[model samples]
Target: MKKLILPFLCIFLLVSCKNETKQGDSNSNELGTAVKDTVIVEVPKVPIEKTIKEIKEALTAKGFKTFEYVDETTKDTILMQQYFMAFLKRSAIKMQNEEESERLQKLHMEHLSKMHELGYADISGPFGDDGDISGVTIYNVPTLKMADSLAKSDPMVQAGRLEIEIHPWWAAKGIGLR
Candidate 1:
Protein backbone atom coordinates (compact mmCIF):
# COMPACT_ATOMS: atom_id res chain seq x y z
CA MET A 1 0.00 0.00 0.00
CA LYS A 2 2.83 2.42 0.86
CA LYS A 3 4.66 1.70 -2.37
CA LEU A 4 1.45 2.19 -4.41
CA ILE A 5 0.68 5.52 -2.68
CA LEU A 6 4.22 6.83 -3.34
CA PRO A 7 3.98 6.14 -7.12
CA PHE A 8 0.48 7.67 -7.33
CA LEU A 9 1.60 10.91 -5.62
CA CYS A 10 4.69 11.15 -7.83
CA ILE A 11 2.63 10.63 -10.98
CA PHE A 12 0.04 13.20 -9.93
CA LEU A 13 2.64 15.91 -9.29
CA LEU A 14 4.55 15.05 -12.52
CA VAL A 15 1.41 15.17 -14.65
CA SER A 16 0.20 18.46 -13.13
CA CYS A 17 3.59 20.17 -13.53
CA LYS A 18 4.08 18.81 -17.07
CA ASN A 19 0.95 20.61 -18.34
CA GLU A 20 2.08 23.90 -16.78
CA THR A 21 5.58 23.53 -18.31
CA LYS A 22 4.09 22.80 -21.74
CA GLN A 23 1.82 25.85 -21.48
CA GLY A 24 4.79 28.07 -20.49
CA ASP A 25 6.97 26.70 -23.32
CA SER A 26 4.24 27.32 -25.90
CA ASN A 27 4.02 31.06 -24.91
CA SER A 28 7.80 31.70 -24.83
CA ASN A 29 9.72 33.35 -27.68
CA GLU A 30 12.95 31.98 -29.15
CA LEU A 31 14.91 34.47 -27.06
CA GLY A 32 12.69 33.77 -23.99
CA THR A 33 11.45 37.40 -23.78
CA ALA A 34 9.01 38.37 -21.04
CA VAL A 35 5.48 39.54 -21.83
CA LYS A 36 3.64 42.32 -20.03
CA ASP A 37 -0.12 42.76 -19.79
CA THR A 38 -1.53 46.13 -20.90
CA VAL A 39 -4.62 47.84 -19.59
CA ILE A 40 -6.43 50.71 -21.34
CA VAL A 41 -8.88 53.18 -19.80
CA GLU A 42 -11.23 55.32 -21.82
CA VAL A 43 -11.48 58.97 -20.75
CA PRO A 44 -14.63 60.96 -21.47
CA LYS A 45 -14.27 64.19 -23.40
CA VAL A 46 -15.06 67.29 -21.34
CA PRO A 47 -16.55 70.37 -22.93
CA ILE A 48 -14.75 73.69 -22.94
CA GLU A 49 -15.25 75.88 -19.87
CA LYS A 50 -17.88 78.60 -20.40
CA THR A 51 -18.33 81.83 -18.52
CA ILE A 52 -21.09 82.25 -15.90
CA LYS A 53 -23.17 84.36 -18.26
CA GLU A 54 -22.70 81.81 -21.02
CA ILE A 55 -23.82 78.97 -18.77
CA LYS A 56 -26.91 80.87 -17.62
CA GLU A 57 -27.77 81.70 -21.18
CA ALA A 58 -27.43 78.09 -22.29
CA LEU A 59 -29.55 76.80 -19.43
CA THR A 60 -32.26 79.37 -20.00
CA ALA A 61 -32.23 78.73 -23.73
CA LYS A 62 -32.90 75.05 -23.06
CA GLY A 63 -35.88 75.83 -20.75
CA PHE A 64 -34.20 74.48 -17.63
CA LYS A 65 -34.89 75.60 -14.07
CA THR A 66 -32.08 77.54 -12.41
CA PHE A 67 -31.50 79.73 -9.37
CA GLU A 68 -28.54 81.89 -8.36
CA TYR A 69 -27.32 83.19 -5.03
CA VAL A 70 -24.24 84.99 -3.78
CA ASP A 71 -22.07 83.11 -1.28
CA GLU A 72 -21.33 85.03 1.90
CA THR A 73 -17.74 83.74 2.12
CA THR A 74 -16.60 83.61 -1.51
CA LYS A 75 -19.21 86.12 -2.78
CA ASP A 76 -19.27 84.28 -6.10
CA THR A 77 -22.55 83.87 -7.97
CA ILE A 78 -23.55 80.19 -7.78
CA LEU A 79 -25.59 78.83 -10.66
CA MET A 80 -27.73 75.82 -9.79
CA GLN A 81 -28.86 73.65 -12.70
CA GLN A 82 -31.61 71.03 -12.50
CA TYR A 83 -30.71 67.58 -13.75
CA PHE A 84 -32.69 64.34 -13.73
CA MET A 85 -31.66 61.30 -11.72
CA ALA A 86 -32.99 57.91 -12.81
CA PHE A 87 -32.90 55.31 -10.08
CA LEU A 88 -32.60 51.79 -11.45
CA LYS A 89 -34.47 49.54 -9.10
CA ARG A 90 -34.68 45.79 -9.12
CA SER A 91 -37.83 44.58 -10.83
CA ALA A 92 -40.14 41.67 -10.00
CA ILE A 93 -39.08 39.41 -12.84
CA LYS A 94 -35.50 38.25 -12.44
CA MET A 95 -35.84 35.15 -14.57
CA GLN A 96 -33.23 35.51 -17.27
CA ASN A 97 -30.72 32.77 -18.11
CA GLU A 98 -27.00 33.52 -18.00
CA GLU A 99 -26.76 34.15 -21.72
CA GLU A 100 -29.79 36.43 -21.81
CA SER A 101 -28.54 38.32 -18.78
CA GLU A 102 -25.13 38.83 -20.39
CA ARG A 103 -26.71 40.09 -23.61
CA LEU A 104 -28.98 42.45 -21.75
CA GLN A 105 -26.04 43.81 -19.73
CA LYS A 106 -24.08 44.45 -22.92
CA LEU A 107 -27.01 46.27 -24.46
CA HIS A 108 -27.46 48.27 -21.26
CA MET A 109 -23.85 49.44 -21.40
CA GLU A 110 -24.23 50.41 -25.04
CA HIS A 111 -27.28 52.46 -24.17
CA LEU A 112 -25.35 54.19 -21.39
CA SER A 113 -22.45 54.92 -23.75
CA LYS A 114 -24.79 56.45 -26.28
CA MET A 115 -26.37 58.62 -23.60
CA HIS A 116 -22.96 59.86 -22.46
CA GLU A 117 -21.87 60.51 -26.01
CA LEU A 118 -25.05 62.47 -26.65
CA GLY A 119 -24.48 64.55 -23.52
CA TYR A 120 -27.65 63.32 -21.89
CA ALA A 121 -26.31 61.28 -18.98
CA ASP A 122 -23.60 62.95 -16.98
CA ILE A 123 -22.70 59.86 -14.96
CA SER A 124 -24.03 56.34 -14.30
CA GLY A 125 -22.94 53.45 -12.13
CA PRO A 126 -24.14 50.64 -9.93
CA PHE A 127 -24.36 50.71 -6.18
CA GLY A 128 -21.73 48.86 -4.13
CA ASP A 129 -24.26 47.13 -1.91
CA ASP A 130 -26.94 44.77 -3.15
CA GLY A 131 -30.22 46.52 -2.46
CA ASP A 132 -33.55 47.38 -4.01
CA ILE A 133 -31.86 50.18 -5.93
CA SER A 134 -29.33 48.73 -8.34
CA GLY A 135 -27.90 51.78 -10.12
CA VAL A 136 -28.52 55.39 -11.12
CA THR A 137 -28.08 57.54 -14.22
CA ILE A 138 -27.90 61.30 -13.96
CA TYR A 139 -29.49 62.82 -17.05
CA ASN A 140 -28.39 66.26 -18.11
CA VAL A 141 -31.52 66.72 -20.15
CA PRO A 142 -33.90 69.54 -19.28
CA THR A 143 -37.19 67.61 -19.27
CA LEU A 144 -38.23 64.67 -17.11
CA LYS A 145 -40.11 63.09 -20.00
CA MET A 146 -36.95 62.89 -22.08
CA ALA A 147 -35.04 61.39 -19.20
CA ASP A 148 -37.77 58.78 -18.66
CA SER A 149 -37.71 57.83 -22.30
CA LEU A 150 -33.95 57.43 -22.26
CA ALA A 151 -34.07 55.30 -19.14
CA LYS A 152 -36.83 53.14 -20.51
CA SER A 153 -34.74 52.44 -23.60
CA ASP A 154 -32.26 50.47 -21.51
CA PRO A 155 -32.46 46.78 -22.34
CA MET A 156 -32.47 45.68 -18.73
CA VAL A 157 -35.35 47.98 -17.97
CA GLN A 158 -37.27 46.82 -21.00
CA ALA A 159 -36.60 43.18 -20.21
CA GLY A 160 -38.27 43.57 -16.79
CA ARG A 161 -35.04 43.12 -14.88
CA LEU A 162 -35.00 46.73 -13.69
CA GLU A 163 -37.32 49.71 -13.28
CA ILE A 164 -36.59 53.41 -13.52
CA GLU A 165 -37.73 56.16 -11.13
CA ILE A 166 -36.78 59.61 -12.20
CA HIS A 167 -36.48 62.71 -10.04
CA PRO A 168 -35.22 66.22 -10.51
CA TRP A 169 -31.74 66.77 -9.08
CA TRP A 170 -29.91 70.08 -8.74
CA ALA A 171 -26.21 70.87 -8.59
CA ALA A 172 -23.94 73.77 -9.35
CA LYS A 173 -23.05 74.12 -12.99
CA GLY A 174 -19.48 73.03 -13.90
CA ILE A 175 -19.17 71.13 -10.64
CA GLY A 176 -17.60 67.69 -10.80
CA LEU A 177 -17.67 64.71 -8.46
CA ARG A 178 -14.70 64.67 -6.13
Candidate 2:
Protein backbone atom coordinates (compact mmCIF):
# COMPACT_ATOMS: atom_id res chain seq x y z
CA MET A 1 0.00 0.00 0.00
CA LYS A 2 2.90 2.41 0.85
CA LYS A 3 4.73 1.58 -2.38
CA LEU A 4 1.58 2.15 -4.46
CA ILE A 5 0.90 5.54 -2.74
CA LEU A 6 4.52 6.74 -3.35
CA PRO A 7 4.47 5.85 -7.09
CA PHE A 8 1.01 7.49 -7.54
CA LEU A 9 2.17 10.67 -5.78
CA CYS A 10 5.36 10.78 -7.93
CA ILE A 11 3.31 10.34 -11.15
CA PHE A 12 0.89 13.14 -10.14
CA LEU A 13 3.76 15.52 -9.36
CA LEU A 14 5.52 14.69 -12.65
CA VAL A 15 2.32 15.30 -14.68
CA SER A 16 1.60 18.59 -12.92
CA CYS A 17 5.20 19.85 -13.44
CA LYS A 18 5.11 18.80 -17.15
CA ASN A 19 1.80 20.64 -17.64
CA GLU A 20 3.15 23.81 -16.02
CA THR A 21 6.29 23.73 -18.24
CA LYS A 22 4.17 23.22 -21.37
CA GLN A 23 1.91 26.15 -20.39
CA GLY A 24 4.90 28.46 -19.89
CA ASP A 25 6.46 27.44 -23.24
CA SER A 26 3.13 27.89 -25.08
CA ASN A 27 2.56 31.33 -23.47
CA SER A 28 6.06 32.51 -24.51
CA ASN A 29 5.53 31.30 -28.09
CA GLU A 30 2.11 33.03 -28.27
CA LEU A 31 3.55 36.27 -26.95
CA GLY A 32 6.41 36.09 -29.43
CA THR A 33 4.50 35.16 -32.61
CA ALA A 34 0.78 35.93 -32.10
CA VAL A 35 0.89 39.00 -34.33
CA LYS A 36 -0.02 38.05 -37.88
CA ASP A 37 2.15 39.49 -40.64
CA THR A 38 0.34 42.17 -42.65
CA VAL A 39 1.25 43.30 -46.15
CA ILE A 40 2.99 46.68 -46.16
CA VAL A 41 1.71 49.11 -48.74
CA GLU A 42 3.04 52.60 -49.42
CA VAL A 43 0.62 55.31 -50.49
CA PRO A 44 1.78 58.06 -52.84
CA LYS A 45 2.02 61.43 -51.16
CA VAL A 46 -0.37 64.16 -52.35
CA PRO A 47 1.41 67.19 -53.73
CA ILE A 48 1.25 70.04 -51.20
CA GLU A 49 0.56 72.64 -53.87
CA LYS A 50 -2.39 70.65 -55.25
CA THR A 51 -3.75 70.02 -51.78
CA ILE A 52 -3.52 73.73 -50.84
CA LYS A 53 -5.13 74.75 -54.12
CA GLU A 54 -8.00 72.32 -53.51
CA ILE A 55 -8.56 73.62 -50.00
CA LYS A 56 -8.46 77.24 -51.18
CA GLU A 57 -10.98 76.50 -53.90
CA ALA A 58 -13.30 74.72 -51.47
CA LEU A 59 -13.09 77.58 -48.98
CA THR A 60 -13.78 80.12 -51.71
CA ALA A 61 -16.79 78.14 -52.92
CA LYS A 62 -18.09 78.15 -49.36
CA GLY A 63 -18.00 82.02 -49.34
CA PHE A 64 -15.00 82.28 -47.03
CA LYS A 65 -12.34 84.88 -47.86
CA THR A 66 -9.14 82.84 -48.09
CA PHE A 67 -5.58 84.07 -47.55
CA GLU A 68 -2.59 81.97 -48.49
CA TYR A 69 0.53 82.48 -46.42
CA VAL A 70 3.95 81.18 -47.38
CA ASP A 71 5.12 78.15 -45.40
CA GLU A 72 7.02 80.23 -42.82
CA THR A 73 6.23 77.58 -40.14
CA THR A 74 5.13 80.26 -37.65
CA LYS A 75 3.99 79.02 -34.26
CA ASP A 76 0.26 78.97 -35.05
CA THR A 77 -1.39 78.12 -31.72
CA ILE A 78 0.29 80.96 -29.82
CA LEU A 79 0.00 83.35 -32.76
CA MET A 80 -3.67 82.51 -33.24
CA GLN A 81 -4.42 83.17 -29.57
CA GLN A 82 -2.54 86.47 -29.66
CA TYR A 83 -4.22 87.59 -32.88
CA PHE A 84 -7.68 86.69 -31.55
CA MET A 85 -7.10 88.46 -28.25
CA ALA A 86 -5.85 91.60 -29.98
CA PHE A 87 -8.82 91.69 -32.30
CA LEU A 88 -11.26 91.20 -29.44
CA LYS A 89 -9.58 93.92 -27.32
CA ARG A 90 -9.61 96.41 -30.20
CA SER A 91 -13.26 95.70 -30.88
CA ALA A 92 -14.15 96.05 -27.21
CA ILE A 93 -12.22 99.31 -26.92
CA LYS A 94 -14.13 100.71 -29.90
CA MET A 95 -17.35 99.99 -28.04
CA GLN A 96 -17.33 103.14 -25.88
CA ASN A 97 -21.06 103.95 -25.92
CA GLU A 98 -23.60 102.05 -23.82
CA GLU A 99 -25.44 100.98 -26.99
CA GLU A 100 -22.23 99.54 -28.45
CA SER A 101 -21.44 97.71 -25.20
CA GLU A 102 -24.96 96.30 -25.09
CA ARG A 103 -24.64 95.18 -28.71
CA LEU A 104 -21.30 93.54 -28.04
CA GLN A 105 -22.67 91.79 -24.96
CA LYS A 106 -25.63 90.49 -26.92
CA LEU A 107 -23.33 89.28 -29.65
CA HIS A 108 -21.19 87.47 -27.12
CA MET A 109 -24.21 85.75 -25.63
CA GLU A 110 -25.46 84.71 -29.06
CA HIS A 111 -22.03 83.37 -30.02
CA LEU A 112 -21.84 81.30 -26.82
CA SER A 113 -25.37 79.93 -27.29
CA LYS A 114 -24.66 78.96 -30.89
CA MET A 115 -21.46 77.21 -29.88
CA HIS A 116 -23.24 75.28 -27.14
CA GLU A 117 -25.93 74.14 -29.58
CA LEU A 118 -23.15 72.79 -31.82
CA GLY A 119 -21.84 70.48 -29.06
CA TYR A 120 -18.44 72.04 -28.41
CA ALA A 121 -16.73 73.44 -25.34
CA ASP A 122 -15.59 77.05 -25.67
CA ILE A 123 -11.81 77.62 -25.70
CA SER A 124 -10.79 80.92 -24.08
CA GLY A 125 -8.23 83.30 -25.60
CA PRO A 126 -4.63 84.17 -24.61
CA PHE A 127 -3.59 86.45 -21.72
CA GLY A 128 -4.20 90.19 -21.99
CA ASP A 129 -5.19 93.39 -20.08
CA ASP A 130 -8.85 92.76 -19.21
CA GLY A 131 -10.15 89.19 -19.08
CA ASP A 132 -13.46 89.94 -20.80
CA ILE A 133 -12.22 92.19 -23.59
CA SER A 134 -8.95 90.42 -24.41
CA GLY A 135 -10.13 86.81 -24.30
CA VAL A 136 -11.53 85.20 -27.46
CA THR A 137 -13.94 82.28 -27.40
CA ILE A 138 -13.20 79.27 -29.63
CA TYR A 139 -15.17 76.08 -30.21
CA ASN A 140 -14.49 72.88 -32.15
CA VAL A 141 -17.74 71.83 -33.76
CA PRO A 142 -18.79 68.29 -34.62
CA THR A 143 -17.57 68.33 -38.21
CA LEU A 144 -16.09 70.56 -40.90
CA LYS A 145 -19.50 70.64 -42.55
CA MET A 146 -21.05 71.75 -39.29
CA ALA A 147 -18.32 74.32 -38.79
CA ASP A 148 -18.84 75.71 -42.27
CA SER A 149 -22.59 75.86 -41.73
CA LEU A 150 -22.10 77.61 -38.39
CA ALA A 151 -19.62 80.02 -39.95
CA LYS A 152 -22.14 80.94 -42.62
CA SER A 153 -25.03 81.32 -40.19
CA ASP A 154 -23.31 82.97 -37.21
CA PRO A 155 -23.04 86.77 -37.44
CA MET A 156 -19.85 86.79 -35.36
CA VAL A 157 -18.04 84.32 -37.62
CA GLN A 158 -19.35 86.00 -40.79
CA ALA A 159 -18.29 89.45 -39.56
CA GLY A 160 -14.78 88.10 -38.84
CA ARG A 161 -15.18 88.52 -35.07
CA LEU A 162 -14.57 84.78 -34.71
CA GLU A 163 -11.94 83.85 -37.22
CA ILE A 164 -11.78 80.14 -37.98
CA GLU A 165 -8.43 78.83 -39.13
CA ILE A 166 -8.57 75.30 -40.43
CA HIS A 167 -5.38 73.31 -39.95
CA PRO A 168 -4.23 69.91 -41.08
CA TRP A 169 -3.22 67.52 -38.28
CA TRP A 170 0.43 67.64 -39.37
CA ALA A 171 0.50 71.40 -38.79
CA ALA A 172 -1.24 71.31 -35.38
CA LYS A 173 1.57 69.89 -33.24
CA GLY A 174 2.29 71.13 -29.70
CA ILE A 175 -0.90 73.19 -29.52
CA GLY A 176 -2.49 72.49 -26.17
CA LEU A 177 -6.25 72.92 -25.67
CA ARG A 178 -7.20 76.20 -23.99
CA-lDDT, candidates in order: 0.90, 0.47
User: How do the predictions measure up, each by TM-score?
Assistant: 0.71, 0.30
lDDT, candidate 1, at 39: 56
Off by over 4 Å in 1: 1-49
TM-score of candidate 1 on Cα atoms, chains taken together = 0.71
lDDT at 70, model 2: 46
Report the Cα RMSD per candidate.
Answer: 17.9, 11.4
Best by TM-score: 1
lDDT of 1 by residue, 1-178 (tens): 9999999999999999877666676455555554556458977699667878888988899988888888899999999999999999999897999999999999999999999999999999999998999999999988999999999999999999999999999999877889
**Residue pairs in clash, model 2:** none
